[model samples]
Target: MSATEQPVHDHSTAALDHGRRGSLGQIVSWCLWDFGSNAYNTVILSFVFSVYVTTAAAPDEQTGQQVFANMQTVAGIIVALLAPVIGVWADRVRRRRLMLSVSTLLVVASVSMCWFVLPYETHHGLKYLYLGAGLIALANMMQQVAEIFYNSMLVDISTPSNVGRISGAAWGLGYLGGVITLAATLALFVLDGGFLGVPEQDAMNYRAIAVFCAGWLLVMSVPVMIWGPPAPPAKGDARTLNVVSAYAQVFRHLRRKFRTSPQVLGFLVASAVYRDGLSAVFAFAGVIAATSYGMDTTEIIIFGLAANFAAALGAWVFGLVDDRVGPRFVILASLATMVVFGGLILAISATAMFWIGGLGISSLVGPVQSASRTLLTRVIEPGEENEMFGLYNTVGRAASWIAPGLIGIFTALLGTRLGLLGIVLTLLGGLILFWFVRIEGVTHNRSRVTSAA
Candidate 1:
């Protein structure tokens, strides 16, 4: 198990053998986690619940935004603090399934709380909102950590040659899952108006969606728990570190790895900026449509479905490009596309070209972002995949505070449309920085295999 010794799983062989084994099924199940988790993102965090809390529950839009922002800030801080430690623990214990189960359950419980969010019950709204926000944050953090382990399992399942395809498939499947779940929820609750006599606007309807998400997550996860191979325990003599010690080890590992390879560090920093911009796209899309374009709930849902569908398409199409050209090229291409479309969104906002331009931009944004993720997967080491992704989430969390905060600030000073310009700036800056990065080392690392299992 020494660094030089080829571990049981050789990177190249695993990558090649990925799909040959039960890789396809395992990868699909793994991606389903994203699908199920995004139910929360789509319904609760991004579109529906956010609007409900800010507009319906809070006294005013300003207060609602403040509350939401504060919750995110707290969540970001907590995630930033704990993620690396959890990652280290996962690597040490090689017990990803247990962690995934715990995290998913928390999400289900928290999301179900949405049932308590009655519009007339404004006094209780704040308390519930705060509680929900905390749960959401914790769930999100746990989900992210589980995702790292899930993705790391990819190396165990697939070979180097098909890693890009597997990664792309996982991502595409995730979007597909989101599309299906969202469509079902929308059809059941919003369009059909009542599941078993529960009105769409009633808390029960929303609760149904939460229940569906929770069930979906739990059910889909069973395959991985049952069929996916378990990671072997850390080698003999490897000491288990506590949370504080784990954090210290993470920082030390970061320094050692980054110092040995500056390119990885550069890629990480650049990816952080762009990833935040990518997140902002989904996070604020509904807000922009609602406030700026006068989009109602139905329109927002339509937009989300369309965007997710486009993302699925993008993942498939750009996946080929990622494998053929190289991850760096695909990443740059995606980022460039995002910048163009994001800028177009800002331009079309003040014109009669709202839906025309908006939909066009929306269409491209999904594929471009999906492509970027595929590219990121191409650029990192296999053994270090989870830790790298953990940092990816960390940098993303750190940058998370900026875009939303800036949007609010700019909106307060300028206008909503103008406020969105910050998003464009972030994307463009990330794209530019990416151009200067050297990817040769990463390419070499990805090509090498150190595992033997």
Candidate 2:
């Protein structure tokens, strides 16, 4: 193979069928992990706990929001600094499954600790609020790191031809899982003081939900751990490198990629910008719904359900299209659609308008995310998957602050409605930059090879 070409390694062998479709059991087992992860994504971060942290935990709404933002920024910085090193370590150790398991356990612990974050009106409320935010930060950092190891396992479970579908299936399953868990929490806890009779005092209902989420995550994670394929054997001695030296190796790897695989570099930069925009869209969706459209907590939960359902459907449907038309097309189309819908949300203030635009924008988010991963998997050099995925996480975290920062600035200067302008602009920026990226040829070649084989 040329320097630019990927080599098939023994790591590819763990899956029952290498260079072909994985077994249904393996695929389902792998996808189940994504399903279980929604406990964190949907309940803890996106819908319930974060909202509580802002509305109940802090001394006031603005202070709480600022504190939350600050903690996320801190988490992003840490992830950016450490993702590459962790990726290098995972690649060297060749134990992505074990690393993922350990990282996931850490996340579960952080999430469960959310129970201790009490309301500001309670004794030591402010102190606990800060503590809660710290735990969230820790959870976010660990979650992002876990994703690097998780994503690297994609190659072991799929072939070049079906990668798009498998990726979409995972993302779709995650959204679906989020919806179910969020609904369960709503039915069992958040609604009518919860059927479980958990006291509403001190927001214990919410705390109980956090514990439930941890257990849900732990349960769902079991299938993958039990049945998912193991990492392929390492090529040589297994010597762990320190963080500083790992970073040095990362720089050298980057240089090599720039020369031999510019597509990977280009996609990384473009995806970073767009992915940040996508995250910002969801991150601020609740706030915008509550403040601008006058949505209450229940209304926000209903809206979240709708958005997650739409995203799940979109991911599954577009995944098949991705394999045929190429991931590049799917990404470009999704980005363009999101940009337009985001503008629609900014333009109209009616609740109906928010629903329409919000769901439209959300529907495309999963497709964009799934396709981006598929595209990267198509182009990356084999055996270096973990490291490259780490860079993916690094670049993403490096730019994570853009949308939030822009939204804050715009909201301060213009108005709450105009804050969405920041998200739209970020998406537009990514769309424009990604337009110049040339990965169609890579996908085309891979398809041909797969077909011939």
Best by TM-score: 2
Task: Return the TM-score for candidate 2, rounded to 2 decimals.
Answer: 0.94
- lDDT of every model, 2 decimals: 0.65, 0.84
State the weakest 10-residue window (summed lDDT) of model 1: 6-15
As a TM-score, model 1 comes out at 0.86
Worst 10 residues of 2 by lDDT: 8-17
Q: What is the TM-score of each candidate against the true structure?
A: 0.86, 0.94
Q: Write the per-residue lDDT of candidate 1 for residues 109-149, one digit (tens) a residue.
A: 66665566555353544665565555556566666666666
Off by over 4 Å in 2: 1-21, 443-453
Error of 1 at 445 (Å): 12
